[model samples]
Target chain A: MDKRKDAGSWNRHKIQAVWALLTNSYLIGFAQGRIYKGSLKNLCLPGLSCYSCPGAVGSCPIGAMQAVIGSWNFKFPFYVAGFLLFAGALMGRFVCGYLCPFGLFQDLLHKIPFPKKIKTFPADALLRKLKYVILAVFVVLLPMVVVDILGQGAPYFCKLICPAGTLEGGLPLVLLNESMRSAIGWLYVWKNALLLLTIVASVLIYRPFCKYICPLGAVYSAFNSVAVFRYQLDQEACIGCGACAASCEMQVDLIKHINSPECIRCGACKRACPVGAIHFRQAGKSRQSNTTGL
Target chain B: MKRQLQSSKAGILLALAGLLMAGVGMHRGEMSTVFEKAVKICMECIGIG
Candidate 1:
C-alpha cells in the first residue's frame, strides 16, 4: 500500500501539520481563557484559522473579509480581497492542504480506523460546487446587502454557519466561564447543532465542509491553474496509467485536471505516481512549462 | 495550449495588481479597522451576538 511506502519515506503532510500548529501557537492565551490582543492580529493568516480561538495569534482571512464587508463604513474590502488574491496566486489551495487547522481536524477524523472507509458517492462531485455558491451568496453578496439601521451588515456566515467558530471560540469560552452559559441563546444552539453535524460528517467524509461549504477554499481554488507554486506533469514520462488520477481523494483526474480547482496540493499524487512523472515545480520555469499539459 | 499559456500570464498579472491594491489600502489605514475588530472578542463569531 502507498501508506506503508509513505511511512518508510518522509511524510510531508505530517510535517505540514506540525508547522501549522507551531505557527499559530499563542498558547498562553488558551491557558488563561483569553484571546490574544496583539498587533499581529491585524494580519490575516493564509488559511482559515479562526480569529476568536484563544490560542490564535493571526486573523482568519474569511472573517476579516466579512467584517470589512459588513462594517458600518461600507467600503469595498480592498485589503482582504487583495490579500486573498495574492495568497491564491502564491500557492493556490496549498494553505488548505497544509496550513489550515480546520482542514487538519477533518483529515485526522477521517483516519479514525473505522471498520468501513467512506468513499466519494455520485452526488459528491455535484456537491463540491456548493462551496462556490456559498462564497458568492454568504461571503460576498449577503455581507454587502443585508444591512441594519446603522447601515452595518451582519457577518452572516460567522453568525449562521462556520463550525470552526463554534468549536474553537464558543465551546471553549462557555466551558471556561459558567456565567457565559446563562447568556446562551438560539444562535448558540443553532451553531452547536452545525458544529455537531460537521464533526459527525468529517468522520464519514473527507473534508466535508471544505468540499461543500468553505468560502475561503472556494476563493483560493480559482487560482490553482496559475499559482506560482504548482504541479508539473511530465507528459513524456506518463504512460496514461491513471494511477495519479485514481490516487486523488478529491476525485480529480490528474491527467486532464492537473491543476483543477478541487486539488488541495497535498502531494498525494506525487507519492502515488509510479514513474515519478508528477511533482511540484515553479510555475514559470521553462522546463516545467514545456512538460505541463494545461 | 496557447490559450492556456495566455490565461496563466493573465493570472500572474492579476495577482500582482491585487497585491498593489492591497498595499495602497493598507497605507490608507484600512488595516486600523482590522486591528480594532481583532482586539475585541467578536461576539458574533462565537455565535452569541
Candidate 2:
C-alpha cells in the first residue's frame, strides 16, 4: 500500500478508538457489583468523561477537581492538579484531538451538510482568552474561594455550561430510568436546551466550544511546548509555501511554531506540509512516516 | 508476538480499571449514597432541588 494510504488507515483506527470510548454506554451493566472503594484516584484520562456515567470506569478529573475544591475538609486537589500536569505533559492537546467524547460529537456534527462554514475571524483571538479566564474563575477559584467558604460546592461550569454532561451523562440516564425524568426540573430543561444549542452550533461551526471555551483544552494547550509527543519541523526543507497554515483550522502557523497552543496535533498541518518537514516525535524513537506531506 | 502481548496487557488493564470504578460506583448502598450526597450539595449551591 502507498505510504499516504497507510497513514490514512492509522488515522481511521485512531478515530475508531475515539468513537468506542465516546459511546461505551453499554459497559455500564458490567460495572454492577464489580468496582470497589479504594482504587487509583489520581492521574486519570485527559478528556472530560463524567464519573457519574454508568459505563465510565475512571474518575473524571474535572469532577474530582470540583469535589475537592467544594469540600470544606480538603484544601485543594493536588492529586488532580498533578494528574492534569502529567496528562498534558504526555499528550498535549492530543486529548482534544483523539480522546474527548464531546470533541468527537462536535466533529460528527460538523460533517452534516451546511451551506456556509464558520470561518475564523480576528475576534476569535479575544474569544479564545475567555476559556483561560473561565479556568481561573469558574473551574479553579470559584469553588475553592466562594463555595467552600460558604459550605457549598457545585461543579459550576458542568452545571451551567457543559453540554457534554447533559448529552453524555444526563440524557442517557433519563432515557433509561423513568425516575430520573420525574425528578427533572427547570435546571435540567436549561441544560438540555444548552446541549441542543451546542449541537446546532457545532453543525454550523467548526468546534466553536473547543476553539473558544473548554478549560480542559486551555490546560492541555499550556503544556504543548514540553509535551512528550512533540511536533518537530525541519528548517532545512526548502520552499516556505503557506499551505500548512491554510489547511490548519486551529490557525497555527506551523513554520513559526510547531508547538503552538492552538495546535491539537490533528495532523492536518502535517498532511498539508509539502516538503515533509512537520512530524510527530515520541520520546527518542525513530521518526516514523506520518500524515506529513500528504 | 511481543506486540500482541502488549496489546492484551493494555486491554486487561483497561478492563480491570473499568470493573473497579463500576464496583465502587454501584455497591449496594453506596451508589445511592454518593448520588444523594452529590445532589444535596448541588441543590444547596444552585438552589434547584
Candidate 3:
C-alpha cells in the first residue's frame, strides 16, 4: 500500500515527531557537548533515545536496565523492568510505533523514495528472533553475569551494538569535545560501520533494527498478545480483501495472526481496511471507530 | 473466550504489580541511581570516553 494512502500514517508521524522532540529537549546540551543532569533523567523513556545524547532529557529504558544490573550493587533493575511492564501491558509495541526515536529515524529514512523497497525476505521469521537472543545475552545476561574483578559490568549492548548510541551520543560528543577526539579508537570505527550499515538498511527496508535487533522491542513484543490496548479484527465486518496485510510495513498477516507479537500496532491495517473492520479495543470499553488518541 | 479473559486478568495484574514495584524501587532510591548514570557521559560504555 502506498503510505500516502494509509490514513493512519500521517497522525502517527506527527505523534512520533512530537514525542521525539519532547524526549530529547535539551537543545543547549547538544551545543555544549554535555548531557542533561536534571532529575528528569531518573524517569525512563519508553523509546530508545540514548541518555548519553547531548539533547536527551530522559534515560533510555534499555540502557538504564543494563546500568542497574551491571552496577556494583548488581541488583535486578526493578524500576526499569516495572516501567517496561506497565508500558507493555498498557499498549505493547505502540511505544515503538509512536514514541521510539530510533523507530522514527528509520520511518523517515524508509520514506526517502528509493527505487526498490524490500518489505520482507525468506529469512524474515528466523531473523526476527535474533533480537530475543540479543536481549537475553547482550542486554540481560552479560551485564548480570560477566563482570570485571571489581564486579562492575559494562553496557555491552551500548558499547558494541546499539547504533543509536553511536549516532546520538558518541558522534556528537566526540565532535563537540576536542579532548574526547584523541580517545577515538577501533571501537569508534566499528560502531560507525554498524551505524552506516543500519542507515543503508533503513533506506532499503522498513524498520530492520526493530524487526531484527532491538531488545526493547523484544521485551514489549512479549506483552503484545496480552496488552490491554490492542488491535482486533471483526470477523463479521472483514471482507477477506487482505488490505490489512498489504498495508502493514512489518508484513504481519493481519488475519491469521491478528495478535502476532511482530505487530507494532501502527494502525495502518485499521485505516487500510475498506470495510473499517479493524478497531482498537480497550478492555471494558467499546470498540473505537478510528485510530485517533491510540 | 476463556483465553482472552485470562489474558485480560493477567495484563491487569501485571500492571498493578509494575505500579507496586516501581513505587518500591523509587522508595529505595533506584531513581537516583538512574539519574547518576544518565547525568554522566560514560566514555567506555558508548566507547567514546
Q: Which candidate has the top score in TM-score?
A: 3
Which residue pairs overlap in candidate 1's backbone? none
Quote model 1's TM-score for chain B. Answer: 0.84
TM-score of chain A, predicted model 1, versus the true chain A, to 2 decimals: 0.92
Q: How much is the lDDT of residue A31 in candidate 2? A: 40
lDDT (Cα atoms) of all candidates against the true structure: 0.79, 0.64, 0.86
In model 1, how large is the Cα lDDT of residue A15?
56
Model 2 lDDT per residue over A178-261, tens place: 666678888888887878888898888778888888889998898776666767777787368977788776788888887899
Model 3: per-residue lDDT, tens digit, A214-264?
Answer: 999999999888888777778898999998899889999989988688898
Could you estimate the TM-score for every candidate? 0.91, 0.77, 0.95
Expressed as tens digits, the lDDT of each residue in A61-114 for candidate 1 is: 888888888887746888888898988887889888877888888877777667
The candidates score, on chain A by TM-score, as follows 0.92, 0.87, 0.96
CAPRI quality of model 3: medium
After superposition, which runs of candidate 1 have C-alpha atoms over 4 Å from their true positions?
A1-5, A8-10, A286-294, B1-11
- Candidate achieving higher DockQ, 1 or 3: 3
DockQ of each: 0.63, 0.05, 0.67
